[model samples]
Target: MRRLVARDERWPLREAFVIARGAKRQAHVVVVEITDGVHHAHGEAVPYARYGEDVPGVLAQIDALRPAIEAGADREALLRLAPPGAARNAIDCALWDLEAKQAGVRAWDLVGRPPPSPVKTCYTLSRAAPAAMAKAATANARRPMLKLKIAGADDLAAVEAVRAAAPRTRLIVDANESLSFEDLQRLAPELVRLDVQMLEQPLPVGEDAVLQGYESPIPLGADESLHTRADLEACAARYTCVNVKLDKAGGLTEALALAQDVRARGLDLMVGCMVGTSLAMAPAMMLTPGARFVDLDGPLLLARDREPGLSILGSMIEPPPAGLWG
Candidate 1:
């Protein structure tokens, strides 16, 4: 029989992580470990309140499913039994880890994908006063790309501030579904002027249908607006790209299929992450080959991380270290 262990951890961020919705100083995540005989594997997920997930609730769900999961439940079975959320993410990831351990291969290698190498990624400039945001961008000028988070009417100033601060860095904007139609229409030209490469989820989740008849200079990506294959038709009509998060998509089992489907539809893809340890980012890094952007900097915000972590050089994510699961 396999033993299942789950726990909650609150890692303090080196600095406050801001977005249009609010600011955060701590990243709360839930971790699950499954062990049988001498083999052990682990998985992690951020308890995103925005998605109606709380640490206690997710842990409870995992505890209830421990017996079934340890009894050799497959990823699909885990998804069906737990619903799609942090609990399922942890369980799904744990299964992948176990498989990797038994096969004596990294998860990426087992999936027929090359291990992660250094890849340029977008570093987030969270919402703040224009001046403060500019300072943050300036400090991170060496980063190849910057993903600026904006909210409300001050967005224009935010973009301008970052552009001025890091003139050479490629810029992307993520409104986190805070902008209105008027905001998009008014900001598209300025975004172009600032050389913003893409815009992510400017409108609310279910309301992205507004982009059906809209036109903008910068490519628009779906994050909160798109999750599973079920969201494809509407997302296809509205977005030029889709951001895939393992937690949101269930796990690599589903994310891989979703990526293939989205690519077939000709949409640009981005692999993103919630705030967690390198354990979370390591799995996500495996999905980067076809991605136009990779936002696996969740561990970068943490004041500490799990031992034997993936390295982040500026905005580039290095390959996972040996013994780092996935």
Candidate 2:
């Protein structure tokens, strides 16, 4: 019989990660390992509080499915066994890794995708005062792209400051469900003037209907408003792009399908990640081949990353080695 193992780990951040929701000093993650005596594989995910997931709760969820997983429930069966969330994400990715090792082939090969090339990821500037944000932007000025976390108030000032600091850096502003329709309308023109290429989740989830007929100067991406394929139809009508995260989509199994569906529907794709370690970001690289944006900078924000992590050269992230995760 196959054996399954699950545990929680905490990795401290280099500095506090502040977003519209709040601040976090460390990443709390759930890790899963699956082995069949001879071969082993691992996966990791972060339990997001916004999704009502805590480390203890996610651990419990994984433990509840231990029997089924060890009983030979494949990735397809996992979809029915657990709802989309951090718990299922860890298990699903672990199974994918296990399969890759068992077959002696790379995970991307099994998925029928080319090997992931080194993709340049956007360095994130956490929510801060305009001056502070500018300082952070200046520090990362050499990076090709920068994503700023913004709230409703003084957002324009912050973006302007960042633009002035890093004039050539492509910018993406994420409101994290903090903005209203009026806020987006008021800021879109100013953001465009500041050369901001995209705005993410500016409006709250249920309020996206207001954008159906609105014209935006900058392309808008759906994050909290779009989780999986189930949310495609509604989100496609309102947003120009969708940000896919493995944890939000449950795992690579669903994430790959979601990424393809997003592209097929003519929406831009952005592969994003929560504040976690390299193991969490490793599986997400599989979706970056044709992505319009890649935000797998989680490990960059951490004080220290797990060993056998993906090699990050400057802002470019290399794919995971077989020794890591798929």
Candidate 3:
């Protein structure tokens, strides 16, 4: 019989991670482990309040599914057993890790993908005043790319400050569903002129219809607005790109499928992550092969990461070793 274990953990951030939504000083994550007497594997996920999930609720959800999981429920079985959220994400990824260990092969082999390669990731600067943002941008100016978290007001000044501080660094901005249609319209032209490469989730989630016929100079990528394949059709009509995160898609199983659908629709792909540990970012690395932007900088923001984490060299993230999860 298989054994299942799930628990909540908190990892402190190097500094507060502020976004348009709010700020967090720690990442609250739920980790799941499955073992079949001889072999064991693990998975991790961050419970996002925006998705109506909290650590206690996620832990309870996982506990409720313990019976089925220990009885050998596979990844496909999990889709019907649990709704998409942080709970299913932890369980599904643990199953993948367990399967990879049992077979003595990498998880990519099971998914029929080539071995993952080191990918360049964007360093993120939290929402702050223009001067504060400029200071942070100056510190990371040598990074290949920097993603700025912006709120509607004073955002132009913040981006302009960042651009001036890091003239050679590529820039992308995320509004975290905090912007209105008018805010996007007013900011798009200036962002383009500042050489900003992309703008993510400017409008609120359900209100994405506001972008139906509108065209902007900078490409808009859907983050909070797009989750799994079910959300693709509506988002494709409104946005030029999609951000795929394992926790948002439920797990790697669904994220891989969503990545393909994003490409099939001719929308650019960006694999992103919540502010968790490297364990949470490891599985997401699988989706970065052809992605236009990779934002799996979860560990970089942490004060300390789980040992045996993915190797990050400067702005590049190396693939996770089997010991870490696959």
Candidate 4:
């Protein structure tokens, strides 16, 4: 029988993490580990309040699944038993880790894929006032690219401010489903003039149908707009790119499958993250090869991260450490 272990961690953020939903003080993550007699593996996921998950609830669910997991539950079967949330994400990742360890190969390799190379990633400048956002962008001007998070009407000011602050750096604006059609229309010209590379999830998930046949100054990416493969067909006509997060997709099994399907459908890939530790970001690196942009800077937002973190060189993400998962 396999053994399962799990725990919750509260990693304090270096600064308040603000978004359309709200602000976050800590990145509350739950990590799961699975071990057979000879090998062991681990996975991490954030318990998001927006998703109706809490630490206690996730732990209880994992406890209930222990017997089934030890009795030989494959990832597909595990999904059937647990709904898509942090609990399942943790367990799914741990199983992938265990399999990779047992096979003496990286998870991606054992899963039948090549390793991802170093990729240029976007360093995020969280939502702030126009002046502060400009200052933050100026401070990070050395980064090859930057992703600016905007919340509401001040978005134009925020984007313009960041643009002026980092004139040469490539820019991507993520409204996090906060903007309206009116806002996008008004800002398109400015975004184009500013040379913004992409606009990510300008509207809420269900409201994205409004973007159908819409002409955007830049390609629009799906963040909350797309989750699983089931969402792909519906989003095809509405979006040019898909942002994949291991947590939202329920870890590597589904994330890899989704990435493959995304490429097959001629959609650009963007590997992103919730505020998390390197353990979470490490597994996500496997999905970065075909990514148009990577935002695995979760570790950078944390006051402190778990040991042996990924190297963030300016805006480039380096390879994961050996034994940090695939």
Candidate 5:
């Protein structure tokens, strides 16, 4: 016999996490658990408002599937059952965790992906004033890579401030789709000069089509615009890389497929995350192999994370402990 459960959780952030979109003081997550009397496993997902997902809706989606999942529905069946989003992510990952625990093997082993090793992740500097961002960057100068959240036309000012404060640290800039195509073109040369390694979603999803065939100095990656494989072909023409957040891909099952599709398009991979505990990052960690960038520092931003969390020191992230999830 099988049992399934889903519930909502809220974790306070150590400080407000500010991005181009806005600010979040807490990470709202939906957790799913599955068991067969003894062997048990769990998965966690952050419901993102940008993707039109909310806690109640995600929980309802998971709740609706309990009967099917308990009746022996598998991961493959889950892809067809739920559209790509947080709800499916929770259930699919929980299924993987349950299967791995039942089989006495790691989730990576089951997926045919290589065993996970320690990965270098990017520390995010929240959207802030130029002086404040520089101060924050200086405080975190030990980090190897810093992902700056940029918002306005004055992004170059903020980037310059951060770069000057943390000269040795590599940088990735995420505009969160706030820049217009003209502004992006105007800023590309300056970003390269600043030695920024990448730019994430500089323009809004609807406005991103303008980036197609526009040569850029720094690599441009798709985030909100690139979800399932359905967005692959179009994204290929617009950006050089794609950010795969498990919440957007649904779960590990489809994330693997999406990464495969990304490679087919000759785009670089970046495994990112929505703010949550280590339970969320554990599964996302499985996708970091050979990825150009890993942005799994969500747990680092929280005031407190669950026990057995991923060990993160600055930008260096150790793989998730077995007891966490996968």
Candidate 6:
């Protein structure tokens, strides 16, 4: 006797969110709410087209699990039930929420993690021409850290623009797997000169095998190329860090494990989020303490966020409010 509710939601972004891949004006997400009659909890997931996930496909995956979930299947059962992706992420988080409500405890406590404290988050400068990107960077100039999306060689001018606008702000350039080794090498000097703290996923996953012996001036991080704990071994040798998004690792359960594995291998951890609501960012906050960088600014990009959202005072994300899912 559990109840499961699943649906799709669309939150309009304040403006088009541009990445190396493309542009999006809205965040399309799948939401799940599970209840044990007396108490309930929610989870949210963005059906990333990059992962070949669409709203219908993700919902169908959850529908397939309804019988088992209603029969009291736990989060571990979900890992085997659904392949790791947006679908699994939504359900896994929902289960965590439900369990927390049932035990009358916080989600972090249920997961055996420390309660979150406010952390500095990366404000993203979407992919744009140098001037536009620079203007955006200047607008967020006060932010402690900024993540610049690099689409190609033209982004050199964009980086220069941002640097000119915000001289003191720390920078992380996420190429989103758009650069070849030569492209990466050509930009390395400029990136270091700009004092860019991190270079993220400049090369595509399959093609990144060349990174093993490359001498990179700036520390590089993996986003698209790193997934579960399984990716830690190979990525540790190639990347100095890995960006852990709950969508990629399936949920908080796997993300915690991935973070532990990344640390065990001496790789830096970055907790990132796809554009969604605060519900998505709240669980990710659990990983923030150990992360080298935090990119949980999804709600800030949206035109409107759900009530009881995580408070954002400037670029810092505070812990989740009680009314919001843990």
Q: Estimate each model's TM-score.
A: 0.97, 0.99, 0.99, 0.95, 0.98, 0.98
For model 5, the stretches where C-alpha displacement exceeds 4 angstroms are none
Spell out the clash pairs found in candidate 3: none
TM-score of 1: 0.97
- Tell how far residue 158 is off in model 3, in angstroms: 0.6
Candidate 2 steric clashes: 0
- Shift in Å, residue 187, candidate 1: 0.9
lDDT of 1 by residue, 1-326 (tens): 78899998888998899887889999888988888878888888887888887889999989999889878887878767877778888888888888888888888877787776788777888899889999999999888888998886467897899999999999989999898888888888889888999989999986767799787788999999777788888999998999999888877777888889989999999999988889888777777887888888888889998887888777778887647775
Q: Each candidate: RMSD to true structure?
A: 1.2, 0.7, 0.7, 1.5, 1.0, 0.8
Per-residue lDDT of model 5, residues 155-264, tens digit only:
79999999999999999999998998888888989999999999999989888888887888889999999988888889999999999989999999889889988877
Residue 46, candidate 5: alpha-carbon lDDT: 88
lDDT of 3 by residue, 1-326 (tens): 99999998989999999998889999999999899999889999999999999999999999999999998899999999998889999999999999999998999999788899999999999999999999999999999999999988458999999999999999999999888888888889999999999999999988889898898789999999988999999999998999999999999999998999888888999999999999999999899988999999999999999999989988999999999996
Q: Locate the minimum summed-lDDT window of 10 residues in model 2.
A: 151-160
Assess the local accuracy of residue 109 in candidate 4 as a C-alpha lDDT between 0 and 100: 83
Better of 3 and 4 by TM-score: 3
Cα lDDT, all candidates:
0.85, 0.93, 0.93, 0.85, 0.91, 0.91
Candidate 1 local lDDT, residue 318:
86
Q: What is the lDDT of residue 32 in candidate 6?
A: 96
Q: Per-residue CA lDDT of candidate 2, range 1-326, in tens?
A: 79999998989999999999899999999999999999888999999999999999999999999999999999999999999999999999999999999999999989688999999999999999999999999999999999999988467899999999999899999999998888888889899888889999998878889999898988999999888899999999999999999999999999999999999998999999999999999999999989999999999999999998989999989889887886
Error of 5 at 24 (Å): 0.7
Residue 217 displacement in candidate 2 (angstroms): 1.4
